[model samples]
Target: MTTQLFVPKFRVDECLAQVKECLEKGWTGMGFKTVEIEDRWKEYTGLPHAHFLSSATAGLHLAFEVLKRKHGWQDGDEVISTSLTFVSTNHAIKYAGLTPVFADVDKYLCLDPEAILDKITTRTRAVVFVGLGGNTGQLDKVAQICKEKGIALVLDAAHMAGTRYRGKHIGYNADVTVFSFQAVKNMPTADSGMICFKEQSDDELARKLTWLGINKDTYARTAAQGAYKWKYDVEDLGFKYHGNSIMAGLALVSLKYLDNDNSYRRQISKWYRDELNGVEGIEIVPVAEGCESSTHLLQLRLERRDGLLVFLNEKGVYPGVHYTDNSEYEMYKDCGQCKNSVKASNEIISLPMHVGLSKNEVDKVSCLVKEFLKG
Candidate 1:
C-alpha cells in the first residue's frame, strides 16, 4: 500500500542484540527480560511498582479487577468515562461486572471534567479517564473530582507511552494507570502493556491477579534456593495476563529508544502544524495545558471529514479514524448514548502517525490534507 496507516520501525541491531542474548540464555518465557522491562518502566516513571501484561486490554481488565477487589465492587456499579475512547476501555469495565457511564469529551477529545461533574451520582464509584490521542484533557480536574468524591481514578493511557503532565508522568496522577505497547503505538513491542498502581497493596494485589492469582510469579518462583516448586495459591479469581519473555525483550529494547523515536513523532506533528496552519474548515487539536504528549495518533476534526478521508485514500494516503462510537457496535449497542460522541466520531479522522514517517512524508500528507480541504 502506498499509504501506510502505521509502520513501527524497529532498531534491528538493538532488537536482534537482545534476541541474541535471550537465545544464548535459552530461557525465554516471561522471566529476566520481563523483569528488566518492568524495572526500566518503573525507573522511567519513578513509580514504585510496574507489571507487564500481554496487552493493554489485559492490563485494563486486570486493573479493573484489582480495583473491584480493593473497593468491594459489585455488579451495576458505575464507572464514569468518556465515550470518545476505544471500546476496550468500556469492555474492561464490563468484564469486571461494572457499568461504564459515558461522559462527553472536550476539544482535546479527552473526557470533559465538567461533564463528569454533572454525571456523578450515588452509584458512581470510579472515573476511568482515557488520555485520548495522548492528550491529558483536564486530567487534573478529573483527579480532583475523583478524590473529592472518593472515586477511583483509573486511567486508560493507551496512547500516552511517554506523555507527561506538569513534569509528572500520567501514571503518577491516576490511582491506576495502564499503558499499551500495541503494534501501532509509539512504544511498539509486538503487544504489551504496563500497569502501575498508586498504593503498594493494590500493586501487590494486581501482581497476583495478572498471573493466575498466584502470590509468586514464575520469575520469583525460580529464584528459590531449594526446589523450584509448583506449589501455588489462587488468592483471587485471576487471569493469565502476564507478558511473555519475547514481548518483554522487544519492549525493553524499544523502551530504551522511546524518547528518541517520540521526538521524531513530535517533529512530524509540528510539521503538520506549520504546513497546514490556517487551512480552511480544518482544525488541528491543540496541546492541553501542562501536558506534554507522546503524539501517538494525530487526529483531525474537519468539515466533511469522511470526504477528506476518501480523498486522502485516493491520493495514496491511507489515513484512518482512531475510533468509532462504541454505541454503534452491536455488542455495545446498549452503551450510554452521547449525541456529542456521535458528532465527534463522525468529524474526527486519524492521519498517518509513526516515527518511521519522514518529514518529507509528513509534508506530503499535509499538502494532501490542504488540497482535500480545497476540494
Candidate 2:
C-alpha cells in the first residue's frame, strides 16, 4: 500500500446526512446552511464577522481588494509577502493591483519579522502572513510589528483551520483572516473558504462584493414578504464568489470534528518528532511558543530532499514538497532573492500527514527515513 503524503478523512455518513437536507429542501444555493456555517465559524474562531466564499483564493483576493479600495491604495502599492508559500498567496496581491514584495521565511518556514521590516517601504499597505503547515512561528512578533507600523495584516490561514496562538484563535489579531476548506485541507469541503474581518462593516461589504455587488443575497430576498424585496441594486464591482449550500453542508459536518481531527494530526506529528529525535542530517521544523497548531503538515529540513523523496517513494511511502520559492516564478523573478526562503525551498520535505494516517504507519515511515539516511 502506498503511504500517501496526505489522505483526507471525511465523516461520510454525517456529511451525507447534511447534504441530504440540501437535496431535499430544494434550497441549495448561497443561503440557509451557508449562513449557519458562517455563524458557526464565527463562534469557532471568535472573529467578529465571517463570509463564506467559493475558495480560499477568492477570500485572499477579497482580503487585499477590499482593504485596497477602502484605504485607496495606489495601483503599485506594496504588500510584503513570504516567498515560501503557494502561488495564490502572492497572486491575490497582484489581483488587487498591488505589488508583492517577496520577504524571507524563518527556520519555521513562516515570514521573518526582520525580513518584513527590510521589505517595507512608504507604499507598503499590508503584510500577508502565511502560517505554513499551521505553525505560527514568530507570528505574534510579526503581528506586533504590523501594529507598530500601522500596516494591515492579512493572514493566509489556509492551513490554520483550528490553530490558536497565545490562548486565542489565530484570526482575532489579524486585520483579515482567510481559512481554506478545500477537499484536502483539515476541514474537508469540496472547495470553499471563510473570510473573517475585524469589522462588521467590512464583512457586510464583503457580502455585497461576493455576490456580484448585490446589496442583498438571494436568501435575504427570499425571506422578504413583499414583491419590493426582490428589488435590489449592485453597489460595487464584484465577482461570483459566493459558496453553495451543498459545500456549506459538508463544512458544517466537518467543522464538528475539526478539533478532534487536528488533535490526532498533532499526535502523528509528535510521534514523528520522537522517532526522528537526534537523527543525523535531519532537522525537524519547530513550532512557535504558545501556539497550538492545526498540524496540517509535518515538515523537515535536510540535504538531498528530492533524493529522500525518491527513496521514500521506492519504499511505498510518498512525501511531498510544500512549495518552491515564489521568487523563482516568472512573474516574481524581478522581486530579487529571498535567501532564506530559497534555501528552505530546496531542502524542505512534507512527510505524510493527515488524520487517516495511523501511528503504526507513521512508525514505518519514520523507520524508512532513518534507514535511508543511514545507508
Candidate 3:
C-alpha cells in the first residue's frame, strides 16, 4: 500500500446523520448547525467567543478587518509575520490593507519572538503568529512581548486544532485566533474554520461582518415571532463568509473524534522520532515545551530533502513539503529577508501523517528515509 500525505478520515454514518438532520429541517445555510458548532467550539476550547466561517482564510481576513476597524489603524500599517507559512496568512494581512513585515522562524518552525521584536516599528500594529504544524514555539513569550509592546496578537492556528499549551487550549491569550477545519486538517470539515476572539464585542462584530453586515442574522430573524423578522439593518460593509450548515455538520462529527485522532497522530510522530533519531543526516523538529501538539505534520530537517522526497516516491511512499518561504514569492520579494526561513524551507519535509497509517507503515517509511541517507 502506498503511504500518502494527509488522508482525511471521516465518520461516514455519523456525518450522514448530521447532514440528514440539516436536510430534514430544510435549513442548510448559515444557521442551525453553524450555531451549534460555534457553541461547541467555545465549550471545547474555552475561548470567550467563536464564530464559524467559510474557511480559515476568511477568518484570518476578518480578524484583521475587525481589529483594524476597532483600533482605527490606518492603511499601510504593518503586521509582523513569519515567512514560513501558507500565503493565506500573509494574504489576509494584505486583504486588510496592511503591510506584511516578514520575520524569521524558530527551531520549531514557528515565528521567532526575538525576530518579531526586530521587525517592530512605529507603524507596526500587530504580530501574526502561525503555529506551524501545531508546534507552539515561544508563543508564550511572543504573546508577552506583544502585550508589552502594546500591539495586538493574531494567532494563525491553521494547523493547531487540538493543540494545547500549559494544559489550556492554544489561543487563550491571543487577541484573536483562527483555526482551520479544512478537509485535511485535524478536524476535517470539508472547508470551514472557527475564529475565536478574546473579547465578546469582537465576536459580535465578526458575526455581523461575515453575513453581509446585517445587524441580525437570518437564523435569529427566522426564530423571532414579530414583524421585525426582516427589519435588520446593514450596519457595515461585510463579506458573505459565514459557514454553512452542511460544513458545520461535518465539523461536529469530526470534533467528536479529534482528541483520539490527534493522540494517534502523536504516536505516529513518536514512531518516526524513534526510528530517525540519532541518524546522522536527519533532525526531527521538536515540539515546544508545555505544548501538547495536534501533530498535524511530523516535519524533519535534512540536507537531502529533495532527493529523499523522490526516493520515497519511487518506493511508493510519498512525503510532502509543508511550505516554501513566503518571501520567495514575487509578490513578497521586497519584504523577503528572513535567512532562517529560507534555510528551513530548503531542508524541511513533512512526512506522511494521517489516522490511517499503522506503526508498521511508519517504520517502513522511516527505514526508507534511512536507506536514502546511507546512500
* Candidate 1 residue lDDT tens string, 95-130: 999988888888888888888988898999899998
Better of 1 and 3 by TM-score: 3
**Tens-digit lDDT track of model 2 for 1-375:** 889987888889998898899999998899999999999999998888999999999999999989988888999999999889899999999999999998888889999999999988999999999999999989889999999999999999999999988879898789999999998998989999999999887888888899999999998888988869879998989999999999999999999999999999899999999999889999999998898999998998999788899999999998989899988889999776888889999999999998888889999999999998998
* Model 3 residue 325 CA deviation in Å: 0.5
The TM-score ranking, best first, is 3, 2, 1
Residue 97, candidate 3: Cα error in Å is 0.3
How do the predictions measure up, each by TM-score?
A: 0.97, 0.99, 0.99
lDDT of each: 0.85, 0.92, 0.94
lDDT at position 347, candidate 1:
91
Candidate 1 worst ten-residue window by lDDT = 224-233
Error of 1 at 192 (Å): 0.7
Encode model 3's per-residue lDDT on 1-375: one tens digit a residue.
799998999999999999999999999999989989999999999998999999999999999999999999999999999889899999999999999999899899888989999999999999999999999999999999999999999999999998999899999889999999998998898999999999989999999999999998888888888776778899999999999999999999999999999999999999999999989999999999999999999999998899999999999998889899987899899775798999999999999999999999999999999999989
Residue pairs clashing in model 2 are: none
